[model samples]
Target: MHASAHVDTFARDHLPPPGQWPGLHFDLPELRYPARLNAAAELLGGGVPERPVFRTPAGPPWTYGELRARVDRLAHVLTGELGVVPGNRVLLRGPTTPWLAACWLAVLKAGAIAVTVLAQQRPRELRTMCAIARVGHALCDVRSVGDLAGAGIPGLRIAVYGGDAPDDLLNRRADAGPFPAVDTAADDVALIAFTSGTTGRPKGCLHFHQDVLAIADTFSRHVLAPRADDVFAGSPPLGFTFGLGGLLVFPMRAGASALLLEQAGPRQLLAAIAAHRVSVLFNAPTAYRAMLGGLDGHDVSSLRRCVSAGENLPEATWRAWHERTGLRLINGIGATELLHVFLSAADERIRPGTTGVPVPGWRARVQDGNGDPVPDGRPGLLAVRGPVGCRYLADPRQREYVRDGWNVTGDTYVRETDGYFRYVARADDMIVSAGYNIAGPEVEDALLRHPDVVEAAVVGRPDEARGRVVVAFAVLRPGARPDAEALRAFLTAELAPYKCPREILFLDALPRTATGKLQRFLLRARGDTGVDTDGDQQ
Candidate 1:
């Protein structure tokens, strides 16, 4: 089936070669969508009109009807006023705000592909995305407009929001009638989400219009089982896929409201949950761990469902949270290439250490280097195929990701006899020391069990005797100081001798990306500087 021709074929033309794409499966009846569909219409156009759609601490609540009107008006401004045409890539850079959410919906409503970037990104990163996507138009937060301007993309048109600006999106005429959503094909590229690029240059993950709703219908509908009355809250920036699904798509799909906080730390998130009566929480394990320290002061009884992704959730963290709140952390493993969670379990089905079975409408397996299924309980590459899969825009690495009709995520895992998948490490993260293969996350998980350790990241350093030696960077809990020898001894009780860290370096905090994922590559860069003999210093 040929996709409906887009006005600007830049994105379609640059998609990975047809044969390199994973075999997308939508066999489930609910997964089947019409050939001509607009995700913006499906996600935001049909909801409880009088029900609140978004609420912030200081801003007035926006009902579904109000958000729809704002989106329609913005669509008119983009098409009628700014002359945006179908297939045009519009860059969106901003914090998590109602305006930013409306702008994203408006871009899709206007038949343009949305290219979102974190507001915290520097000029260099912005330039890279702009050049790669060939962006000609942008909607930026007022505070980030200067950085967007510094990107120096030729012929770029930008409109700022959230502050006084001559060309602010909020200032656009709202008197116009509702602008009709564009009739985009189901397979038409709707978003170009760039990867976090911790190891290398960020690659654009092109998602189709149908891919947007697939995540909500499959994961949110089946795994999360959200209700229309649930109020969602989270810390991930909207630019990230995890955040997009958590804060917007999932809630909107369930006809629920989302609490959009511009800036959310552990403290602020806890306060919002109590103040707004938020019931559904989504954040990384690090944020959850941080919140554990302050849980005594807040009434988080309002939160019924807590979702953790973006990084592996250690069993220690999961057990601690469950023990305290009587709510099991719903751990999921997803990637930008696949849109959202594909492996997860909710409620009673959740197993503390394993990242649940394949989500409904998806299939997963562990495969060896030759693309054959590995034996159960043996570690190998994780491969998945489902309603949503990878399609990198013009990246040569596309060939490496999709093999034998499966999206070979760079993660290593072991599938148990009962079909539960346990994460071992990233394919590139396994450390080989003296003929022993060790997963860095396993060691980090062990260190986190220590009472004084708040956060831990482990990497391998080159050694003269052994090929590599495990090293760890730890963040101590407030007012708790533990020496390196004590941490090592603590690890000795929990981990095998070969799996323990050779040295532990204390830092104020572990380096992480905007989305709270630890940057092990950065730690590896510092690992070769020689192990610090003295412990409690940054």
Candidate 2:
């Protein structure tokens, strides 16, 4: 490994041991990065200084040169005034905006690890992540600072943007000249992304400077083939890796521009596509389904490429979208541990229901419980290895995720004779609702906090509107009424709105195994019923 430029080595010291790390591959030429590299510098330098980089509906596009200047200034504030050193963890919380993207780049340029979380995350969730990551500084939007401040993290210094405070991030200027990028090692930690797991604890995935560029080179370059003239737009928040790549990293890496929207629902996304003439789009299957009905009044002729992920894209949704827009959706399966899409197909190579073969520089196969490869057409766990692989931050679960140098994603699939992989179901208990991965246990914990609830279990139920909706089954205290609306309202105060259960049912007793363990499968079976508690078909 190259000598690190980090003065604080907390991130490096906490990385999973070499034996627990998944084997990394860099067979492609473009995947080879120099020993000393700064991802922000490479990304910024790859773009034409005069070309637009970020755009919004209410404002003019910010050119690459303008973005670089802003990033440099932010880096100066982080390193000079904030007294941050390399390897310090900086938590970023804000809506999707150009300034939030700039803050991400500035953190990398200054050689600090960025812990970017969703602005909608509750104080409890934020507190858990901050404690696990040892985050000391925060760059938050003024509108979203309440939650982070209420988290009450010890010694966390917050600098708000878009506010009238004298120390607002945008108001702090260090110098007029460019700030030199830190000479960091290629393997130096750049970001710590926290992902929800079945255990209800967030797993922090450690990524390096080179790992950031590797995704752009492998998937975005070889498969997506984005051009400099392409205008990108997406519905995901910047905190999600899907949005991080599609909205910021991939576009800037290709010298293209992106439309960053603070509110990108189906309606807002359709309007942005018509107003900005977006050619490349990224969204979940649920959003695509929602937009299909609204496409008649919008002009989407500028759309050339649309990528679907976060959940399996049903063949029906794919067909309906292709029939309407004459555009084939690029269906992909990726995990937060892998950073970006490693298994995907685009253009003429795409199949209706199956996720395409492994992306360039990546290898994937279906493995049995014993880590042995399963025969074609047999369902098994999906294991993948590539230039970017799993490396948890001092977590014991790393041993469970990486087996024999392969990252075993908790997803079951079938590898067909044609080499295409078909999605089956989540091998774990994670609930994929509206493109967000919600832990069933996390929601159950929130329900259990209510005074009227005695026991609770949560699961994902199939829905025509959303790909899946969180359905909860609970046993209330004796003589307490079954008030689903009241329970939902109480939960809303404890968890994010998305994580709250959409349907709640009262039960006298919960199913359990003979060994006294909760039988979640029975709860899932209950959720799969076609009729609701009132005998109305769902």
Candidate 3:
């Protein structure tokens, strides 16, 4: 690797062994980046200085020149007054807004590794992520600093933004001149994205400067092609790579603008599409399904492209939206490890029930348990190889995710003869509810903390409105009665609201195998209903 600009070298030292990495391919011409590159510099430099690049509902649009100046001043503050150096992990906590986006860019510009987390995360979740990433400095929005403060990370320096406090980030004194971009190596780590802890412990996925740009060149440039005049908006939080790519990176790479919304429900998205003339949209199937029934009087004629992910898009949902709007939904599947979508279909190439072929710089296939290639029509593991792949920070699970030069995503799929991939189901026990990946064991652990709870198990049950809802079965102590709301309230204080169980059922005892192992499969089969240990309905 080229000489890195990072002085601390913590992120580089924690990366998985070189031999454990998946095969990387820079096949496309645009995928090849220079040895010395800064992703923030690359993204911000592409836009025309006079054109608007970011917009909020109540605030005026910020053009490229204005945004650049803000980033430069923030970068100066980060390095000059805050005593930040290259390779420092700076945590960004806030809602999705222009200031949050600017803070992310400024961290990259100052040669620091960004650790962005969701605003809805509780103190427990925040503490775990910050511990894993070894975060020292934090820049949080004034409204969202309460949780981060509650996290109680020792020796963490906190700075508030978007507030009138004396020590606010915008109030810091710094030079207004342009700050030279850090001469970071293309392979140097730029950010560490933590998974939702699908396995009960969040793993940080380290992405390099070039990897950040590669996702844009492959997916945004090849599949969901955007025009400079387009306005992008999405529902996913910027903490999720889905939102990071669709709402910010992809649009900025194409010299387009984006409208950032703090609360983007179906109704809000529809209103924004009409109010801002949004052209390109990114959301999950659940939102699209909800919007189908309320399209009357909403002027969505400006929307030309819609991208859906985070959950499987049903044929029924796709057909209803297409029929209502005369626009085909681009269904794709992506993982946090891979950074962005590698398989997608757009425009005339879309098939209603299948994910399209691999993007221009990616290759994908189905493989069996032993890592052997499966037949075209057989269901197996989805294995993909691309320029951007997984690199876990000090996590031993790297062995399970990458095998034989391919990243084996824990999703079962079948590749057809025509090269289209069909989604089957998740191969693991992780529950995906309402486009959010919620770990059953994590919720179970939270439930077990209650004094009345003896044993607990969580599963995902299909729901018409949310695609799936978290259903939990608990075996309470003998005198305790079943009160779902009480247990839900107990969980809300510890975990994110989305991770709380939507429905709780009482069971005499949790089912187990002969060796005393949890039989989650049995619970999944008996979802939404409680059954006694004797296999009889309660």
Candidate 4:
């Protein structure tokens, strides 16, 4: 792992650091591509037309040449017909369609920052994001055009991609082209990605010209490692960094193929992979588990890598997948603040349950309550620092994120002796009872080990005196009926009395974000945490 090992790679060196650390190898020069064009410009430099760049469910396959052609036409229309001036924010909203991809590239090339808003978001959420981004225009699907029309944002121009365009706006036309690339600096703000604000309101995370350098060098280098001929496909939408990177940037950057499905469910994902012969697979653990049964009829041997992130990777889920597929599921954690997971490992020798070491160009540490360094193998707040940093637009949360320069992610983890960090759940997700502080995930992991459990989410519920008590939500596999009394008896034997949930709530499904993360904040709203407290000493 010498610094010189990655010296010649295009994306390996990016950060401001100069000399390399042989102890933990990193190269600053190779970490980024030169900030010539926006994210779209850097990705489409690969000169090929027939080579697949993006594949949609209903339309023709967009190759490197075809994607670039479409982008050129779209940028031409956006500049000529739509009058999209530079620095103007365009709210690119929709599913992962070819039109959206073309629109995203057009917005960036038009010298406007592309603001991708997910379709799953409520109207209120859309209004909030649009207002914050100062959105001058919106490129959405046909279904959402009307919803956004009545959103009450004044004079916000709306253009439906592939659907009917507004009267003044023009769709794909004969009179558009001769588009020129905008000269953008490395520090120019490229995107304002939103982190799910479970605690309160969503915060805007800004990424500059050099940001994609880290996404490709660090994330792509470590996780997917896609090649030119390889075909990429995944379950996440283009709006999510998971989908944007996994399905779009990573593949197109290397001149690989991307299958962009507008409807990315368990069935569509499997069918697309088998139909398109997708090489790289990226989705949540729940998606992987749900698709396990569907793999029997599909020839999915094209899958080279399967990346799991956005939630804690339970041990049972990981093992079950391995037993079924004989392929390793790469696990990592990413926050919108950091843009993506700065830490991940793809190669073998990966420990079963540990989130592997930090990827190149990033550094992480576990810190104490006072932000001091914590001892190894002890759980503490996870703090990270690298090329990307958090910037909450006009929000005081920025003060909470930056501490002595490092971004203090709201995650609790323990760095084991081998340098791997084991995720213990979010810091707020910890439960305290009597005196000892117990992590809800620990109990959930114990329950998942019971074999009958298919999915689990542990949360701290309200308690009368001890503040909050442990509560468990369990989703059992079909044909296995493990009742509350029997499961509680089993958990009591394995866990400390105070740590075990006083009650278990059964559910067929859990609330989750589009990226496949459990929305534990919902559990808190449900007020499910209560202790038995049957005359037991407190």
**Best candidate, TM-score:** 1
Better of 1 and 4 by lDDT: 1
Model 1 agreement with the true structure over 1-538: per-residue lDDT tens digits: 4465379989888988778889989878999999998999999865799999999998689999999988998998888778899999999998899999999999998889999999888998888888889999999888878988887888899988888666677886655687888889998999999999586888999999999999999999999999999999999988999999999999999999999998889999999999999999999999999999999979998999999999999999998898888889999999999999999999788988999999999999999999999999999999999998899988898989999789999999999999999999999999999999999989988988988999999999999899999999898987876488898888899999999988888888888888787888888887777545333323
Off by over 4 Å in 2: 197-199, 429-538
In candidate 1, list every pair of residues with a backbone clash. none
How many collisions per candidate? 0, 0, 0, 11
Q: Write the per-residue lDDT of candidate 3 for residues 290-347, one digit (tens) a residue.
A: 6875799999999999999876676666777899999999999888899989999999
For model 2, the local distance difference test gives 0.87
- Give per-model TM-scores: 0.98, 0.83, 0.83, 0.89
Candidate 3 yields a Cα-based lDDT of 0.88
Q: In lDDT terms, which candidate is top?
A: 1
When summed lDDT is taken over every stretch of 10 residues in candidate 4, the lowest stretch is 1-10
Worst 10 residues of 1 by lDDT: 529-538
Candidate 3's TM-score reads 0.83
Which TM-score value belongs to model 4? 0.89
lDDT of 4 by residue, 1-538 (tens): 1222111121222222222111222356666455454666777776476776777776677777777777888887777677777667788777777778778877777667778888787778888887766677787777657668777887788877655544423355635444677776655666678776554678777666567556777778656677787877778887787777787778777778788887878898888887888888888877887787677887778787888977777776788778888878888888887778876777684677778888777888999978899999899999888777776555566767777677888899999988898888788888887676888878887887776777787887777888777778888878777488888998989888888987677777777775567888886665453322221112
lDDT of 1: 0.90
lDDT of 2 by residue, 482-517 (tens): 888999899989899999888898777776421123
